[model samples]
Target: MAAASAGRLDPVDGRRTSGARGERVAAPAAPARPAAVRVRPGADEDLRPEAEAALRRLVGRDDAVLRDDQWTAIHALVAEQRRALVVQRTGWGKSAVYFVATSLLRARGSGPTIIISPLLALMRDQIAAAGRAGVRAATINSANVTEWDQIHEQISNGDIDVLLCSPERLNNPGFRDEVLPRLAADAGLVVIDEAHCVSDWGHDFRPDYRRIRTLLAELPEGIPVLATTATANARVTQDVAEQLEITGEGAGRSEVLVLRGGLDRESLHLNVLRLGDQPTRVAWLLEALRSTEGSGIVYCLTVSVAEQVAAQLKAAGLPVAAYTGRTDPTERESLEADLKANRVKALVATSALGMGFDKPDLGFVVHLGAPSSPIAYYQQVGRAGRGVDSALVVLLPGEEDQRIWEYFGSLAFPREDQVRATLDALSRGGTQSAQALETQVDLTRSRLEMMLKVLDVDGAVKRVKGGWEATGQGWTYEADRYARVEQARLAEQRTMLDYESTDGCRMAFLRRTLDDPDLRPDERCGRCDNCGGSTLPAAPTTEHVAQARKAMDVPGVVVEPRSMWPTGMATLGIDLKGKISPAEKTEPGRAVARLDGLGWSQPLRELFASTTPDGEVPVHLRRAAAQVLDAWDGLQVDGVVCVRSTTRPVLVEHLARGLAKYLDKPFVGFVGPLGGHEAPPRHDVNSAMRLAGVAQRLGLDLTPAASAGLAGRSILLVDDRVASGWTLAVAGRLLRQAGAGAVLPFVLAQQ
Candidate 1:
């Protein structure tokens, strides 16, 4: 929903009708008071009636009344002015609690409520919902920079009742140093949606959410705060609650009301289908989605998988769209609207579409691959069956799921040495961008930025306009705590595996994993497949399986050559900067498949496993490489040259020889490392560092015969894999500088 224009509250009925969508919805008239009346400050009378009227207006239904727990949360925020955490299931009116409380608080002449929402989707929904409740709402997020000035003006003029911003915005230099101080001083209430993220133990922990602790600490006493989420277990709940606790006089912890309800959802029917392979799973999904009742989501673990699945489904005459992190923001909104309106069958999505997407009548949710943890699985599945009588939730577990989990696990908090390196870099500087620091540290760009955010939250570093600077504050690594977090994460992964194989009720297992306080040991959700409540469609036809396999078998991903040299290369004694000379640049290249692709992923993963010994290229992969070359219609390669691989030399050599023979081109000698310099470990490092090492260590090792024939000959550069692309780029430049006409890179996989 689009944001409502700033408008004043109606004096007669307290409803804001100006600039809102459609006609103003009217609530049922109260007997001795106005419809949707607000409670006056210090009024000893009960506030339930007024709250009920407000709920009616907010939901646009005269029959809408506050649930007992909703009323309890509202009362605590508006009347008692206490901190509260509402751990209710999705669709339990969590948003209503905050919206109604905003209404009540604004009616009592308090300042506008500041909502620290997590996603742009959530902010849009909250703004639309607030407008329905006669509360004027405006947002300040990355998507609406032009509107921030106006929104701030409206807030100062008391024209808006609720202000929504993302958690990341809270620590932004401008927002933190300017807007937040006033909001903290005069805000009526602060709402932290998806509060579980504030805890490191949560499934989707974000360092940005930790900034909320500083905001909470800055708020004055009696400025009621509310934290809400649907996926927190006992541990996450306690962690978030402790963060919500304010320090009283003498540094004592203040009281925080904790409201946690049962997590069981009767409308959800959970099941797991262990399809033996990716092709079979795709076939099953294709068949299942065809007969599903209503529109829903098909979740994949990676963007590539989501896109591939969506393409497969669409090719089979299904109306579907792929939604992933790489999707454009405008396209995301349009796709979401399409899904909500049932214009499409289902959205093949990654976890990017996980939280804050509201579609009440979603009929089913199918997982193409299992999420890493049960908590994450529960959170994603909770998106379905929210406002419907029943929704089918199925998990198609894959063997590749564990590998994806381990890949993400590798991105956890950096070791003490890495953290200290980052701090040391910042310590010598006025302000150093993450890119500049990357030249000094071994961490990747994303990991370095994440560490910077965590340090900013911990007060060891401060983010400024240009970059970040040290705060001169001493910090510790908290080794024991981080280790425990890692152990907990592993335990969660094991529990998720157990979830797939458990013979008991699926819903009950999820509840137990989440530590549902109201769960009974003997409880079983009769709606699950194990309870004989419902069964999925019959197995997919053999024809369908064959079609899926054929579709996925077509594999070739374009490996775009890197055009610009990475910044700060000069710091490593390299003079290269800005864009590479087009004359020396490699043409667009091809990889047999992505390391995460659906068809070739399994074989590629096995081949690249650390424990696997380097050997000849397997016959199947050799044929796959031939297929890639055969599909390269316009290629004109005179020879093949291999980049020496420190780890997989045999495999790389075999791949190069096979490609050279397939192309019927002369086998050019390898581009081996310099004698006195060992190849650097390029994994997990930034592009600059990777390139620096590659440029310094690698040199052309062609024989004098090959060198004499190299001029004006196109070379097919072969490597086992291309990760940072720096290795390929540097090798291609060397070939071009060696008088090769054009260098075309061909890799086994793109990592």
Candidate 2:
């Protein structure tokens, strides 16, 4: 039986008045069921034979049996035309419920089931699974742009039983204006996968998911909608359930049929192996992966970390590769296939590897560090032990975890000023692409796009063919709501810390965190390292530790040049636009290390701190900088030019002069900051404005002696740090025009 709502977590205001996210509404009373939607007490057996057969086909097995609640959901959606929300564990047959419903509805001559899937991997897996059940499915995503025309034709001709799309596509101008109306009119069933994302209270809320409310409101009444998710607390569930409740005739103020099942995973063996440093933690991972059985995933918290871990593992002769948001789409697909087929030992990945990756018999999941929330951790570790008897799930918490969390927190909600600026810019716009809008607004391209999406959902802006324009509709940024969301996030982080330190049953802890009412914290699973004994070694051997430390300490990262100028620079009143001329481009440069990497970052952070006294280069960093120069591919530099740092002028100048003296080259004067130049704002603004700002501020007013010394001579450009690389590029252009032969850029760090 489904569990009843056990109230909510707590109110941010210390009162029961406001619900989750400080929403000023009560727990929505369960909506009355329509009379025609009633099912008898023994109606679980009423699922049609064809539906059961379709279920078996969906799982690719003859003995697959439908869970009672799964049957209940299928019957409700297929027969009674009622909306439902399925909140079950990851491996629970949520997809089966939707697929069976789609098959039954299509067999009865309904239009194609339109599923709003979250990821391309999820959609790919779902399409394959649907094909196993003899269902023809096609997807329209960025990856499949060329096939969209054929897919749309199939939808129009009723050749497709199902259509899958990403949430972001709902806001695409062409899709929203031309195709969505017809599809909404004809869509038989609307299935929302990973539906927890619809609520801001959820861990991975995307503003685009909010667009579904409009889709729901516009859908003809009585068209059944299904929202499914594996990770949700009572607040998220209640929030999503309220959103799923459609309004119209036959709706009758009814609530979604929320079927939240048990979240316990018997196949998982959880453990925490606390090690002292990054090297020690990495060593533990290498040893554990060797001892563990079958191919699995090693999860890292950041892209750089993932790459570092993957490199360390590969050096130890473990077959591994890194996967993150920056991975190419085609390469991501290939990596997924390789993992499914056990071609590699593990894919060291970020959160991008989670959600909808189905590798049955996968052996283990190891974390280089702990996620900030237990819900997110559970979702990731759940990827393991799916089709196996037992899978090892271990976390190696690092000291840097909290710092990473705070960095991500900064990106949560844009400042009110940024939002207003975006709205104001759009008020006079015919249409402004995100790049064009960046010139008028002070936010980065990615962040501006994110804000615009939220605005689109709020009805303050509308995306058109060329770009986005103001709708002139009034919109409010709920300060309390955002504050409550932040509070909830902090609470989640605290809970995660508790989970790491807790001595109780690990499975019970995860289940309770998900608001599973039946969970007993005292009940021991006799599986986790806390309940049972740990199977991992204490630490890596001394020799292995030394080797790992040496490998990780290897420095020097390549800084790729900016090949193309930022689009819409002309709109910003700059003459520069389009591709940067090849003659002006500098080859990929070198940095001592990335500002976020494990090797030199700690000391670099101390050096770059605002409170630290700025002066000449530190002796230790000077050695490292010399090593970078020595490692460079013998570029014959005739002069050393420094990019003046307003913040780190002394450091930049010292490094440049020292390098020039060491190489026995002339010290080309530093590029000085011109008047009317303000440093780029603390926040990440667009590339065009960043370049424009740098172009206006930095100038190379060379003396006659310096110009005579630089004519036809190669220049080695130096900077304390390289962010956006605009300053270096602009400086390089000036140096080349001043008769320098070649400009090879170098920086102390890349951030």
Candidate 3:
């Protein structure tokens, strides 16, 4: 899924010699059960003419042949005529299935193999690897190439074997004009790597992934869609089939095969450690980094956490690297290389660390904190085993993770308003570019795709060859009903994780997640903290420490670090006071505020006292505003804001107060668009707003449409996560006609 690696979309090297990502996982040792499976009978056949020509174009060996399962999978992988499912695991050589299959197609015939992979690195690596194998695989991404012509030639011409692209790229002319017309009736396949992303039930929900369904719809029925990934449960499998329309009917051929080689690297000790304190856990992790054999991955819950942990790892004298969305493309690539080459022993990261990190033999996968579900836990920890050896997972979680998961995980679904707003926003201008849509949606891009796919299913929008367009229809009763039903199926998975956490059956629970139903109830096997009892198995709990009083920059008032437990008066608006920041322990009472609406919001300001801690209030601003400064930094965090919309006028008023300065105009009446609170509870923007303050205070009064200014001023649109931002988008447009030159809107985060 590399957006650029050499091996990804590697050129169709006629030989099925090298595996994907330098893998050693043997192609599922010839299938056990008999289905009269037939392999292409060509023990002594000459290479396809194209393949032979391709081999001559490169440097290495030729006559690459596929094994039985490899042969079947490859054909399935590259065929322009089948809908297939590949349920292979990490060590099962799944990548080879795609790489070889696509190559074979190009060798035997013509046309490009369009691969939709998960990571940019994976794509680059695939291209690099193919170049080595004598195949030419090129990746198109936000990096290097900025022009459309280059991509057009790369894919449209008969020369390119693979066009590694993202769903987000389909709208670009490089794809719509150059590759798409050729995709029809082309004798090649559309390989979707990390296919679980296509399913909403997948551990890591991606909105863009859902658009694959539309991509499939456009392709000639003969051109097959091959999906491959290691981490997928039952629900994920079903959702994938349904999304791809891989029905069990004539001419609509498809197969869901699971390569059940449990990714258990016995060489890499698997242990679970539990600590009662937070600092202790962080300290132990620091120790592990210092003592571990090689560079490793430290998984955290968010970008902020990853940054904090990276700092801690750095403070301990370790050459640490960090990877998160906040990291620039160049920095991320450099950091990944440093960690892989062992230049940096520890890399602190969030879910961004999940896919395409091909550094096998890693010291370990340390969970600085717990994840929301078991599937996520498996995928994160499974990062270790690679295609060869085993790996380790250190689930170091304190009471905080449990408390947070209990309160928020169950309700994480997208609200009806969020969904509608999202669809409406995406359907703008009757159609909007992916980039424009991304600006107004709240979920991650991948998750946003899935939402779009669902919207496509509903009739809210249609995924066109170049972008998204409104369809003037609703999702079919069947698809909507299916999504509604799948919601429970997905929630049950969370329920299972919770049950296992409570029951202390971590390994069994994880195995079950991968569809290994035969896994039986067993003892802790004396490997985990639960079985070890008082013994130090591994998980640690670090204490939440407040910034030192000396570090505090407050001039007159003392704002002690908020506790996990509630304090008096509950004026802060949530179930508890704001959680303590990692820097809170080192720089107490400092605060900072960040207003959205780039042009409208005031500049970021750090608040501190007149007296300085050391010099220049440490990082600027006085001690009096230091706490506020830090808090301000926290608010800028992408996913922090919860409520995405306001339904009540009073709630809108509360939002206006919070972002008053962000209100673009000098002084214009606010436009309040009521949010659909009746939507699904988990993702209900209203609920998130309630937690923020909208529900805690009095209502807001809306001015008449005529009274609200139009041409001369600006306005503010406040919502928790900014899903869609279209509930009042029309109203915003109306404001423009009335007088407002710029109707500025602010959402907590965009999709």
Candidate 4:
């Protein structure tokens, strides 16, 4: 039904007219019912025409019409002065609603709008969109730190209409302590883009987003707040609404209007193809790129895989680029512009390119491996078919998907002991830097900082000028909630597996998973491969397969040496500091593959998977190790020595013996740990902490035979895995001190 016929205003010819004008005049109703006289809210009626003009101007359309829900949301925010949450699907004009509302409110002499956006790409696009409507939008993000002063000046002078910022900025010491209060006091409207991120139940829960609750509470009453997201499930929606509700004077009294629309995207043709192995998947992707229609994205699970695929395609004479979190900011901008202009076949990317990237006529989206959740998949695929009639969406599920999922899942909320330890370290109420805290805690720097953010949101820790300090507040670790969320994530993984194998409509399955209002479970999309008979070919040509195999089989990844000694070594009773001497330092080394990579990772993982007892190295891995040696480009070592492992002693010895036999070099006896002590230290901390533990608990005693054979000879230091590179560093120093000419470190994999 047309929105106008559904008893709402119509936006036609840049004007909004009420539906009440067409009602027929009737005599006064019988006295059985009390005679009621209704009058339209004069405030909204006065601004409706201006809002329509703003919408028309923003979209560059003369006949633009705000749907029933869009107009309703704008009216509630601008006219009723209430909080609202719009949970519509992508490409549904969620931005238009907020921009129109900003225009309407600013026209009435209100303060500038404050939009808490999540991604820089989204902020850039929004600033441009607002400019078209003459909103004078300016963004303050990490990229444009130099312009913040001018932007703040504009805000103070009432020259800027809208200000965009990341949620992380809300907790920044300078912004929070000095700037936020003033902005909150005079803000006209607050828009939280990607508000689902605020809830732990959300698929992408960010601790920084939880700070929005404090921002909401600080806003003056009658400021009118708006939160918007397209990927929220029922649980996420309820949680976000509760968090977004106005809490002080009008707390819990006025309900937050949540407008949730359907999740079905008629323009997307969803499909899945199960491939046999990595080589086959790569070959199929190469062929698909050659045969596909227009510019699109090819999503991968890891940065290594994305780079590998891009290299393969470029080798096949295709213009492609690899984009991940490691890509430089300026390069990322160039890549986005290239993709927009169709300068490349496709961009092989990770989840970094998932949300808020706009390409109207994007032709397709293909996933080398499925995301762990259906919601994430839906959001990624929604990037395509936004302004086109039809676009292809395919998922090629790999056997390695589950491993990647588990790797990321391990980064969820910290364990109770870890959380408690952080609190205990900060209990003195004095500011301590992250490096100082590392001496007392066992968590890595990245993990510790993440936990601190969560603690800050829970009001147990506060980030001040120098660093962070405990607030002496009571905080409970919600074990049950974390457990439930973990279970939900696992269930989502299983659902994604089911989705790949389902015989029903793919779109319907996605909609049902999101709990869409108009889902028809029994209906087939008639556009997907299963229902439309357009399934991908089962195999690729022999030539393409050979090319893919060659690409995947190329081994040897660089293992850069550690340059500086870890900080706070004195606290660990070690005399190490600053730079390691050139005589003691190990040169750049080589590894067979990354433990998370695709090529030979499976067998390496299996070999290293055992923890109780070690086994002899397998024959194939031995051959691969020999291949790594042959492919190395640097000076050859004189002999081989193993870094003794208590848990994998047999495996390390077997590997060292086999490599010595293969290379026809002297087999130096093992550099075993002193005093029959076994195993490296517990590796649950940062580099400094790990080095401290290793130095205290582990030492190499040069056996008589090894000492006699090692003089002025380069030794190959072999270990099971390279994590943090501290083991290699310390062991290499010992070898150098023992009169070894040069030390070359080699590992099975770099985790």
Residue 730 lDDT in model 3?
A: 34
The candidate that wins on lDDT is 1
lDDT of each: 0.84, 0.81, 0.51, 0.81
259-345, model 1: which lDDT tens digit per residue?
Answer: 777778778999999888999999999999988899999999999999989998999999999999999878988999999899999
Q: How far off is residue 455 in model 4, in Å?
A: 1.0
Per-candidate TM-scores read 0.93, 0.93, 0.63, 0.92
Predicted candidate 3 versus true structure: per-residue lDDT over 388-486, tens digit per residue: 233455677644455345444434445566677776675555666454454455454444555666666445776676568887675433447546645
Query: Over the full model, what C-alpha lDDT does candidate 3 score relative to the true structure?
Result: 0.51
Q: What is the C-alpha lDDT profile of model 4 across 260-364, one tens digit per residue?
A: 776666678888888788898899988888888898999999998898789889999999999898888778888988998999889999987758887778889
Q: What are the per-residue Cα lDDT tens digits for candidate 2 across 1-751?
A: 3211134211000111111111011122332221224775655555557787887788765545565567778888987788888777777678888899999888888889999987788789888989988999999998888999999999999999999999989999889889998999999999999898999998989999999989998988768888888898888888888887776665573666777677777779999878888887887788877877799998888898898889889989998999998899899999999998999999999998766788767789888878888998999888887677688889989887887888778678888888998899888766888888878888877788888999899999998988899988889988899899999999999999999999888888888888874455577778898898446655789887788788877778899998888887777677787787777777678898887667676678779877998899898888888888888887688888888777777899999999999889988788878866536324276787888787777789667899887777888999988888898899988888777778899888888
**TM-score pick, better of 2 and 4:** 2
Candidate 3 regions off by >4 Å? 1-68, 75-82, 144-148, 171-178, 184-187, 242-263, 387-390, 402-453, 462-469, 474-506, 517-751
**Residue pairs in steric clash, candidate 1?**
none
Candidate 1 residues lying further than 4 Å off, grouped into runs, are: 1-46, 250-253
- On the 0 to 100 scale, the lDDT of residue 365 in model 1 is 90
